[model samples]
Target: MEKKNNRYSLLLVGLAVLLVVGLVFTVGRSKKPTLNVYNWSEYLPAEIITAFEKEFGVKVNYDTYSSNEEMLAKLSTGATGYDIVVPSDYAVSIMIHQDLALPLDKEALPNLANIDPRFLDLYFDPGNVYSVPYLWGTLGIAYNKTKVEEPVTSWEILWDPKYKGRIVVVDDMREIIGMALQTLGKSRNSTDPAELMAAKAKLATLVPAIKAFDSDNPKGHLLSGEAWLGVLWSGDAALAGMENPDITYVLPEEGGGLWMENLVIPKGSRNPELAHEFINFILRPEVSAKLAEAFPHGNPNQAAHALIDPEILNNPASYPPAEALEKAEWLIDVGEATVLYDQIWTEIKGGR
Candidate 1:
């Protein structure tokens, strides 16, 4: 009986030791680091995120916002937990001025060498201190070849009476008004109230003809044959072209907005080093090429250009000719004039 009791006591002690060891292992293994990324909707490919997770064993919490304004408003509220953000060129300038973005550590981003020099040290975020260009594109017109009687080479095609109720315009106020401004031979960043009013008037005149104002999925309308023509970002146009070969993208004769979406680390990030790691990961030639394939945008990574699909590389919409690029203008921070733009845009949308 004494020997049996000793054996029972030994079994209980062994079980207790095993339980403690298991708990310690579980706790240590469960504390994986997380990276929170806020980006534009549909901007990144799923495989990129999956690959990053697999490589680093760091969990990614990805979220998306539609516009720069929406992202800025959320960040302005002092809400935390975002380790990275993707903002456009002008928005980067605003965030920098407002001290909403953090300076990037160049040493950590050695892969920055892959980016083309042409995209760097721009007027916005000059010296490339706080942001890195991700994808760039022009705002242009996309038209279904079967629906349009005439070749669409100009922005004036939107105002044509024949296309009434068959046109889709981007919902973005800046982009829409910028198109009008460009058509009227004025700067997209025009602060002149007269120029803005003229642009608003033009838009108001065309409003009755417009089928819908859509940003999230203008390509859907075009694909469904609901909208015969649309003012779209070049990337969206490229997507439309791929899904339906009948669709064609053209840079209007009047020129258009050239935009560069950039990757930035917002202030108060919990994981700055991880953010840098992710940026460098994205900048890798192969990864950058994959991003271009997914989004069909103009890749700023020169090294990645060689790795892109030949068909995509040859597509004029994805890589506009030199003349088109020469005519294109980048949207710049217009300072307090933005208030006037807001007012004008409201008037246009309100049908005033």
Candidate 2:
């Protein structure tokens, strides 16, 4: 009787060990890794994220911010655990300097060759180390053609006293000030204290004429016809025109800021592989085209551009011709100049 009991006890112990191992394996397989993406407000199509979730069986937690500074502040805390982030050209440079991002592993992304070479090797990330170009466009004026009597081709219209309480501009400091600087025949990325101050003065002249400083939906101002003219990103202008064709986009004679938004991986993410997969998925021509169709931004994917509707592709406001791109200046990080720009912006906006 004693021998039989010992044999049964041993068998029961072995079954317990097998059950524990099976439970561990099942738990591991059940927990799908999550990918976190932080991007600009209204920057992406909703369906793309859904599609990624469906295909990869991973949950995507997407969030957005209106400004680069806001994004930086949240990310500085290191608690967000975001796997991917999309920041504008200058912001990418700043993040890289502060060690907020990781250098991408090029071997993992074979689709890197699809990006236009013109956008590659930018001053921000030489050799495209930390970021990949997502979209590129110039800052231009969007105005109601029916309200304005003449052709608008200059930044001066935003300052016109005749349009007092009828003008809107982006709330962004660099972009708003850049418009003024470019109007004064200076680079948008100008580091000269005197030039920035001059730009401040120009902005001062337009302040009272403006209705409100808006960032998220500058197009709403134009669409409602509450403001006849506004400074708009090319994508916003295109969206506005779709609702009202009378809204016209104008590139100033003195040139405007040419901006590019890019995708980057922040440091210490939980799911770098999943983030890479998301990036690769978006780079696919069809997925890229869907983003362009949804947001109307200037897509850098040449293959995606072919997939977009001809009317959208032909839209002057959204995709300005190569000639217009020639005179425009891409914004570069201005190290110490950022503080100066902020001071001037504070003085102007605060009316001090």
Candidate 3:
């Protein structure tokens, strides 16, 4: 009987050990890894997020900002734990200057070779050290065919007296100011205080002609017949055209603001390895093709072009002719000159 008791005690101890091990295994399996992504609104597709989560067995915390300045302001307030951020070309320059991002590990990004060489080595990110091109777009004019009834070749049309109270411009200071500067035959990236003031004055003149300053869904106003003319991003105009055939987009004769958005791994990313994995996944031709199909923006992934439908690839709203591209210019970081521009903008907008 004593020997039987001893065997029973040994079995009980073994059972307790197995129970502990099983509990630990269950807890570990329940705690999945996660990634944080901060990007533009509606830029990334929902299916991509779900696919990545299923394939990697990780959760994604995706957040979006309407503009680069808004993203910068949030980061400036000490926001942290962001694994990835998408910034426009000029914003990339600002982030690089502030040392807010990490150098990419090219070894982990084998699909980086799929990006078109034309989109690489841009002025804001030379050598492509800190950024990778995501998409390219132009700031142009979108107008209703029945309302305008004139050749939309110049930025001057936005200031036409007849378009008074019928025009919509983006709330983005850079895009609106750039249009004014270009219309005056100045550089799209003009940093001179006098030029900026001049542009501001010209924009002030256009205030009477403007109906609303919209950033999100300016196309909505166009579709509703509330706005006949608008300064819009190429992708927004293309999206508008898809809904209504009469919505036409045109590049200004002076030049339009050409821009590119890039993906960067912000500093303090807890999951750097996962961040690299996500970028590599995005660079895959099939994934890029999916993004192109969802958004009408110009896809910088050359390898994905063949995978994309020819109709989308040939759409002039998304991909204009080479000559029109030549007339376009990029906005750049103006260093200390941003203060002057901001001051002018504040004065024009009646900002307190």
* Top lDDT prediction, candidate number: 1
lDDT tens digits, residues 257-350, model 1? 7999999999999999999999999999999999998889999999999999989988877998879788888888788888888888788778
After TM-score superposition, the amount by which residue 91's alpha carbon in candidate 2 deviates from its true location, in angstroms, is 0.9
**Clashing pairs counted in every model:** 0, 0, 0
State TM-scores per candidate: 0.92, 0.89, 0.90
Question: Comparing candidate 1 with candidate 3, which one achieves the higher TM-score?
Answer: 1
lDDT of 1 at 211: 94
**What RMSD does each model have against the real structure?**
2.5, 5.1, 4.0
Per the 3 Å backbone cut-off, how many clashing residue pairs does candidate 2 have?
0
Which should have the higher lDDT, number 1 or number 2? 1
lDDT for each residue of candidate 3 in 217-267, tens digit (9 for 90 to 100): 899989999999999999999999989989988888898979999999998
- Give the per-residue lDDT of model 2 (tens digit) for 126-215: 998889889888888888989987878788777667799999888988888888899999888899989998989888988988898998
Best by TM-score: 1
For model 2 the local lDDT of residue 31 reads: 82
